[model samples]
Target: MGLVTIAGMAESGDIPMREPLAYFLTWTTYGTWLPGDQRGWVEKPGRFREPNRNMEVANREQMTEPEFVLTSPQRALVELTIRDHCKFRQWSMHAVNCRTNHVHVVVTATGYSPDDVMKQFKSWCTRRLKEHASKPEAPARGPTKNPANSLPLTLRQKFWTRGGSKRIIFDQEGMENAITYTLDGQ
Candidate 1:
């Protein structure tokens, strides 16, 4: 598979364009970054909003569970799984970095939509994490404390946010910038 076509509006009689070189993906853990964060937030593509303390407070108050942060081991697991999965899928993995609260990756998956690629990465990472976390040799981490209530978080609690950023890398420069940012800047 090669470059895909970005179809133009059919009713408007638009044509197709070449696909981008790769994708720069970023995702945060659940509850760590709220919608109206002081660091700024995105409502959609090209729709960024100024930081709103009120929005952030409201989002925090409505949380069903406490914010998740990755342990060093967990972060290593995530990063490794990303590379392995990309290799298994035959996707070119340009770069990947995992932080305590988020992850960044640049990859070129020839035939997959960015959303599908992000979803697959998130799904496999979660599965591998859970599998690694569930062993008799290691004591279970016990249960996570929910911020909204007294209930302990079950194993089924969500590990990632609902959606993540998937920016198309249009050229080598963009891909290089993303890779540098992921590997060094953040």
Candidate 2:
């Protein structure tokens, strides 16, 4: 009906696959809530009350590198990329903040799912990051005899995790709260 405000949070590799904090999911008619969760969380559908040690170990084992932390320049690049994408798409971005480990954005785009918006932002930001990383100090005069000496064609490092938190804002109060959190809560 009116402008819909969405809060999207994306984490870096710092957070394990399974966390102690409670996470929620909503279905068509109902939602799942898990309490006092341990290793059997995947079997359940909703909120996990406590930490799962086994899951945490498995997640740690899967780590390819140390926790991915964004530097100040990288964070600034991310913010710029997001703002450019929003402007090109004609979406109203109320606030956006990029931290060392995560990013929070408050935006409104009519007829677009929050998940889709988040994905778009993540995709563009990743491209920008890769471009920055692969840039050469000086332009290449010709193709390199040894391909190994050339810049990498693909990005080996990851900037964002698979999925992120998406919340819908239904009222003015919700929009205000989301903006406040994005701007000040960090």
Candidate 3:
């Protein structure tokens, strides 16, 4: 693959959100574990030849039932939400993929920290999801609670972890890697 030169750079604190930012995000439902090996909702082979253990074969629902992994619909929703929210927030998206276990976003943050950008994105998406899910005639399933809800009222936590893993793309090689990693499954 060749160099993926975005409109701007994915810099650290000094960088802005409007330029270029590549953020790969993975937020779960409460304490729900993702597609790896937490709940075993989607059975896998004990060994390499134990059975068909193709990761691509698994669906998002199977991944999110026990966790809040991105479903196909959710992925589409995320893409649309990203476009709409970015336009509203004046951000730019280089590339975005809603994986089975997490969300990979390659964007441009012209004037915001990765953390702030992610927070804004997550908050906006969450609100949009909540609003889209609410209806007068139908019962709102809404967001699900993790098993951790057994804790006290003050202990009850919200969805998504506190922070995310962000990196700065210094050169074309790194940028290509970031883009490929964001697109192709690991």
Candidate 1 wrongly placed segments (more than 4 Å) = 1-16, 143-156
From the highest lDDT down, the ranking of the candidates is 1, 2, 3
TM-score, prediction 1:
0.83
Q: For model 2, where is the 10-residue window of minimal lDDT?
A: 22-31
lDDT of 2 by residue, 1-186 (tens): 222223222222123232212111111100111212253432322233356666556665665533445556767988999889989998888888887667888777776766678878888877887777666751322222324224232334455665555556545666677777778775
TM-score sort, best first: 1, 2, 3
Whole-model lDDT, model 1: 0.75
Candidate 3 segments whose C-alpha is farther than 4 A from its true place = 1-29, 34-70, 136-157
lDDT of 1 at 134: 73
Task: Report the lDDT of model 2 for residue 173.
Answer: 66
**TM-scores of all predicted structures:** 0.83, 0.65, 0.57
Scored against the true structure, residue 180 in model 1 reaches a CA lDDT of 83
lDDT of each: 0.75, 0.55, 0.50
- Clashes within 3 Å, all models in order: 0, 1, 14
Please name the candidate that would achieve the greatest TM-score relative to the true structure. Answer: 1
lDDT of 3 by residue, 13-123 (tens): 334333333453434343344343334432321212222334334533443223344445545766688778778877667667765445667666666667777787777
